[model samples]
Target: MLEIRQIPVLEDNYVYLVHEPVEKLTAVVDPAVTDEVMSAAASAGWTITHILNTHHHFDHVGGNEEIRDKTGCTIVGPRADRDRIPGIEIELGDGDLFQFGAATARVFDVPGHTKGHIAYWFEADKALFCGDTLFALGCGRMFEGTPGQFWPSLKKLRDLPDETRVFCAHEYTQANARFALSIDPDNVELTMRSKEIDALRAHGIPTVPSVLAAEKATNPFLRADQPEIAAQLGMEGRDPIDIFAEIRHRKDNF
Candidate 1:
């Protein structure tokens, strides 16, 4: 079985540890801070064996080199972005399968936030480690790719099973929820979730690993194809990509 845990780090960033009990192997995903990841591993009683980076953003891979030096973990990431990732030994692209002990992760090229960004999907475990590409109730900003390119990238993720657990890189859900409500006011799921988020935050609980089904229901970015959202944005009958672009544009200002 696979075990996952969240490690809170710098500001609102989140790092995750994926563990395989059979082989006692542990992989750190997007370590924004080295100390936080090391402490998390120490607390979990698991020795780090791998560093899986989803993108080259500094906040995501800032601890790559230090973590590799401290634990000698094998670093893995997008083969196309070898130049950007630090200490990357296993450069992989979309469709490439990787193993950490008995667990396997399938890579998907999900560019938009960054041109070479990728996500790791552990199909059997129904978990997705999508760094900055997909968030709890929002998507990443288009830094290197166009909205057209981003829409297709999000489609690849939306096609995954709704039950898949989404592990994002940040605690942007509350803010994203507020922004989503502006355009998706009629969405009951979003409304209820916003309240839940408020409760979770008030109690200092982490809301990083949200279920994909919930995101599908509440995330405005994913609901671009919905006519209700289109009509709300004055985009009725427009192409889904155009609607999605407008949503993203609004988010940029939100």
Candidate 2:
């Protein structure tokens, strides 16, 4: 079994440490800072052996060099953004299989927040380490990719098993639930989820690693193709991508 630990850092970002206990091999996902990640690994008695980066964003790869230098870990990341990834030793693409001790992860090129962004899905573990691509109640903003490119990227993730646990890189669920309610006010699931999120946030609880089933049922971004959502946007019969773009536009300004 793979043991995963979440370490919150830099206001809202989350750094994950994935460990395979048999071999005691551990991989740190998107370490934004060095000290917290290093300390967490030390406290857990896990030695970091790999750095799995999802994109080239500074927040995601900021500690790559330091961590790798300290532990002599192999750095893996998207081949599309190789130039930007610090200490990238293994450049991976879509459909590529990456090995971490006894576990394996299927790499997905899910670009939207960034053109070279990727996600790691450990099928057996039912875990998806998606950095800034798919969030709990929303998707990442289209920073470098267009709606055309972004929608397909989301579709790939949307097709995953319902039981998959989404380990997104930020604590944005509370704010995302608010935006979801505005667009999908009538959805019973969304309403319930929004209230749940509010309660969780009120108590200072972390609301990440949401189930894929809940996200598909309640996230407005994932429901753009639903007729009800299109009707709510006053864009009945429009292309899903167009509806998605509109929702993203509204959220951008919200």
Using TM-score as the measure, the top candidate is 2
Q: Name the lDDT of candidate 1.
A: 0.92
Q: Which stretches of candidate 2 lie over 4 Å from their true place?
A: none
Which ten contiguous residues of candidate 1 have the minimum total lDDT? 97-106
Error of 2 at 118 (Å): 0.5
Candidate 2 residue-wise lDDT, 1-254, digit = tens: 89999999999999999999878999999989999999999999999999999999999999999999999999999999999999999999999999887999999998889999999999999999999999999999899998888898999999999999999999999999989989988889889988898998899899998999999999988888999999999999999999999999999999
Candidate 1 lDDT by residue in tens digits, 1-254: 89998988888998999999999999999988899899889999989999999999999899999999999899999987889998899998989998877888899998899999999999999999999999999999999988888888888999999999999999998999999999899889899999999999999998879999998888989888988999999988999999999999999998
Error of model 1, residue 29, in angstroms: 0.2
For every model shown, what is its TM-score relative to the native structure? 0.98, 0.99
Question: lDDT, candidate 1, residue 171?
Answer: 94
